[model samples]
Target chain A: MAVCPDFSIPAPFFYVNTFYDILYQSEDAKRIFGEHANFFSLIDVESRRKFQRLAERRFEPQKFELLLNTVQSPAMLFDIHLKWNRDNHCSILCIEQSQRYQQITEVLTRFTQRLGMTNYDLLRRKEELERLLANLQQSNAQNDRLVELGRIAASIAHEIRNPLTSIRGLVQLLAPNLTSSAKLSYIDIIISEINRVNSIITEFLKTAKPAPPLKEAIPVTDLFAELELLCHSESLLQGIELVILPVDPSLMIYADRLQMKQVLLNMLHNAMEAISDLPNSRTGMIQFEAERFGRYVQIRIEDNGVGMDEQTRTHLFSPFFTTKNSGTGLGLSTCYHIVELHGGTIDVESTPGHGTVFRIYLPTVDKKPELS
Target chain B: MNATHNNRFFQASLDLTDSIRMKIIQFAHILLSGDERKSWEFIEQQLVNGIHSTEIFCTYIPLAMTYIGELWIENAISVVDEHIASCVCDYLIMRYQAQYITPPDQQNCQAVVACVDGDPHELGAKLAVLLLNRHGLQTHYLGVHCPLHHFLAFISKWRPSIVALSVTQSHHLKKVQDYLEALQGLPYQPEIIVGGRLIHHLSYTSSKGAPNKQRLFFMQNLHELAGWLEQDYLPIKPE
Candidate 1:
């Protein structure tokens, strides 16, 4: 043990030889070692061997000398070195490392705090990035939809122009003829074509306009019953089964009567097209059922027609995705928009060749009807 | 009184026991057949008796039905048809997960199971979650094609013990590598374990510049995965 010249008693400093005794026996020594102090004494034989190997690699002789000599400040330096002595006792050089250790601890604490702040900043930035990404994706989807709408509009315009040109030519060709019946017939044909063109234009324009507000308390059963009659008549003509389940009388949707009817008609037309073809034995079933959901009236139109695959189902409500031979794909797309405008959502569930179910939810009127 | 007792009480009890036994046998057969709807129905019926679907599906069904489909496939069942069956079974399993009301024990080790980006087949990942959950591990399932950055953010915040990644298709190799590289840079990186069909597609060629740079220990199927999880990955102690 090292001794001070001025004192007759021991200096209370732990020397290299008595270091293990001090670390194991003294609470003050254990406090300096932290949680690792117990590990030094309590480790089993195999663990001690492994730890010794690691310690040897980490605490080399040159690094030990540097650690001891680097303390220039007037503070207790505890150079804790695990070494073997002549007596084969575990020796730890307990020089006063307090001042240098405090400096290192302060530097490390600051670094760790800065690291934590950086991590928090990174997290905030990541959240912002995710939000931006989600927005970008939504915008891209909208852009794609707009482009598809534009294409459909161009084709529709071209179709209308061709018919208009034909009507114009027919009018010009029949200009010289002067007969009452013949003129009336030609005028009737022209008027019908003009009406068709007008209807097409009106439907296309409706897509851009906000849905008209609900003005009337229309009976849900009556509306669905009328739809059922129409579907049944169409089915009779086309040799297909059109089934409408009994509508729930309590399920009244607060919606514009004309707009809601239009939505239902479009869905019914789509269903008719879907099931138009089948061998008589494997003919598809079309069903329309109404049920009252919480705060909303749900109308489900299900078809056992050739149901769509995932890819088709994903874009099923997108404007102008049609498998029809001579029909505008705008039908269901318009229905979807109108439903959305009325504070409602449309969901479709389908399995290929199994069936499709289109569920439309609309808010129900619970309060007294407002006079318009 | 003796005749009444024999007719009403003793006979009714015997009938009830016979019905219960019969139902259980039928349920076992349906499970062995891999009929999802029938299995669900059986599970619902057994609910009154307090039998859990998770226990039946994870233990009994997999043990008996694992090789049933293989035999059928060998005897001329189409591969595409097998995929459809797998899809149905996976869907049912997910439905059960959705409907499961009993809260998983939070005291157990928690894990995040996800499919690497571009690997859209989620059946394998779903199966892994079911098996892990059966073993009493809490699992947070992030479905197929989960973006890498989102996963990293979740990992940092949640700090789960294990991150189980599934890559079903070979096309997701680049994305998986990118995910691993990103994980290496994270502050709270968990122990990463990967499996699925894509691993089988990877070769062990030692040539430089080849796509297969490292030998990923591939798990053949869900059984292998369950074994690996139970033996090597469970009971993770927090650092």
Candidate 2:
């Protein structure tokens, strides 16, 4: 240890005296200087500022710790006492300590302060761990659901593909002799049916595992036109009025065009079906509207139809949860999936007696984050 | 089992010897009669009581199948009787295969068990498929006379660890060689396992000196296959 020649002492004790802006402290005090070399310098910025303000008051003595340099030492403690001396025109700050404190009360006070800090740190870590655990559990549940979907899809695909393969093989045999347009249209129908089956398989796979969207800026007005054209015939047949109200002609969202169409068409079909299902829903109206709020474009498919009960509403977004007698239960689930893939959400507001409003929020093109 | 128990399922467990065999034979006959309600009760009971599935596949069904074939030889049952018995037994075997309990993380040494080109005997190959699958290997049983093209396609898609070929007649031994040649030319090589009635006559081995010689195996039964798999393929640790 480098000794301060003027203040060197043999006892393993510490003392500090302040006079004329010069600190005469014991070797043990010097050893415990946290960073600065002396008692006045050892005080942190906020504490020194507080001392400066308190120093202005008459008969006010500030009691603060001059933190020791604990970097190169073990078994440290600090005791700082400041008092204003009216006669001497100076402040006196004393640091009195030892290898161990003489008083049990002082030890207990330090122990209590450390315990409080440790407890707070422990609580913060526990909360963080619990949050992480909850996230992990949710992700695990999602994965298990996806695996189950894949298993079901695999079995269905196997059963369908055998007959499909046989039909396709027979069609190949018929293709060589076809020269007439009427026969050619039959071939076209077969090919289209095959493509539809393929599409169903693709949809199943999408639900089995979520994938990044093949995104582009798609205008809401254009999408509204597509939905109208597709559902117009069905609406007339089912005696449901399908209305398209385009609030923002220029509102665009970043999403897969085909996927967005499927989502809209699926929702519109469900709306029309819901309207038609009601015993007194002959004068049913299904309305489509698009509007922008903040960074998102909100597309609403509202139906004055048979709104769902609370139990159905709670399980509305879950895959394979359906209220309809013959529904496959993938209608809203797929819509929810596509919106999520585009970094958006699907929300519903409905009650049993009234009607249901399905609101889809897709972020505007400019607001969409850059996909990695 | 008590005589007053009324249930025929646990009757197999009543006796230590030939009684279990007799009980199984009676159930097999019951299944063939298409009385599913009566048959299922006994079958489900045996399965639920933790009877090993291999006991049914390896012992009970084979004995009943042989007995039915013997009845036909003695002119006791007609050809139609034999056909119905075989078909019913096959269906029941498949039903049991579907419900057989396997460990979730079971070892999967992928195997393709099928009849060679021009071989009509599928029952043996089907049993082998079930036996391998039940022992925790992913197995595909392609029924009778798997042509070279289909065989190649199955091999390419599954990339099985073993290609188990079965041929019942001696005349189909030459087809085995052609199948081996086709398999050997493929990019991914799966080991060929040849077996059936005429397996010994073909001298099926990895050697080529014999005329119908090919790299093939002759597992006398599922027991031998299980033994080989346990020695080499099974996972070192229980999962």
Candidate 3:
């Protein structure tokens, strides 16, 4: 309303009365807020409240900040300076601070990028630590197993060595004395029995010092194929139906191939033996299956044979435990040890007249990251 | 272990007014008969039908075991039958817990559930572990008959925030007291939650002399325990 006065300052400046009537505006301010805009209409609500609080104080030179609506931006932050003149009108100056805000935003973006990298590094390191811990546990279990085996191996050697040697020597000496076919067959049986004893001793020694597992991702179907091939002849000989269910192609486990085969073979051998004892009138059958169960691969071997009682089931994994007449009592315990060494567990359930089921749960290897 | 299924297993849905109660009764009968396969089938079917796991655990399993206990109390079943039923229930609970896959990002709230020495019943403790685990807690279940020294050694190593003890027999009060005293001796004291069939015995002034009574809580049933866990104890959101 006053005659258009030229301001001395070059920055965006304004003069307004106590009611916020725009008495004067610099050319730059006019370009930003428009020619006829009120001072209150230029700021956001929050800044209006702040301005009201500031106005309640005594009229003096003051410096503050406000978010202003300008031609360039919706809510631009501005450093505002205000002073009251003798005419009771206030003169105001606003310095745009968008460049400073941009610098602060750049710093924050860098901070967040660094934080994300740190989180990824921490996760990678945690995975490494977990792998190391698993290896340490496996080593500890192996050491304990070796110590227990050493204790039993010494006594077993002392008990079997001299008798085995004498039996071999006697069989060789009597080889020429056998003239008839029936006598030759008896000598053959004696030699084979001695060889079986020697083989049992060797198998027991292998349990004492097992090679560390060469763990790798292996498809379960491939392993099952090998097992079916190896057990095919034995199943044919015993007339037991060995039915291995088809495994999922994507199911995989981290394990030693040879040791895993040994575990399956041992279980298959036990299953066949169990079925061989069944009556001829009843048909014998063994079912082998492997499936993904949560984070583990569950290998299940079930047999419709003469099952074991609770007492036998409890001691089935002991070092020198067996219920068979010609059994060495070492196969199952060795299987148990090998499974433990692979960071797996084996559980058995059986009813005396029905059947037995052996379930081996091994940790699965996840190939897809998104699946997790 | 027995993967084969047959008609004896319960696979059909129910249509009774009190379906949960009927299921509980039938499950108790199955457990008493030592038919684990049937019981597993029943549970799996329930889970497959979209029943909430909390209802299955906090209502079905515990209620079934309680019915078995009641039958044993009334002399309908022998002691051996009761033991067999308990063992079957324990095995199913073990298998069920083994199948739980916790989310990797969930922050763990550690808990230890055990039965006092000389208490033969562990179903209550096992159920507690299952329910707590379902609520985003990492629980270690030390089954019945763990010696005190071994327990203390484990507790010192594990240093859980909660210790849950199940006591079925009132005569095991001495063992509970011993455990409480030993737990108090540790550098980190956990909140002790005592619950079981004989939980009311503690309310009869016998727990006044127990060590760290301020930290002891008597939970009547799993529902109350779960409520407490949701309202006060569960520090993380349930998954």
Winner by DockQ: 1
Docking level of model 3: incorrect
Q: Chain A of model 3, TM-score against the native?
A: 0.45
Q: Give the clashing pairs for model 3.
A: none
Q: Judged by lDDT against the true structure, how good is candidate 3?
A: 0.74
DockQ for each of the predicted structures, in order? 0.01, 0.00, 0.01
Q: What's the TM-score of each model vs. the native? A: 0.30, 0.33, 0.34
Model 1, span B132-152: residue lDDT tens: 776667878887667888888
Docking class of 2: incorrect
Model 3, B36-129: lDDT tens digits are 6677778889899897777777777777766664454333554456656766676566557555645223243378888888675677787888
What order do you get sorting by lDDT, best first? 3, 2, 1
Candidate 3 positional error at B110, Å: 1.9
lDDT winner:
3
Q: For residues A137-230, what per-residue lDDT tens digits would candidate 3 score against the true structure?
A: 8756866886788878767766886789898998899898786555886676578557756755765557546557778888989888877766
TM-scores of chain A, one for each prediction: 0.45, 0.46, 0.45
- Listing every candidate in turn, what is its Cα RMSD in Å to the true structure after a full C-alpha superposition? 25.3, 39.9, 30.6
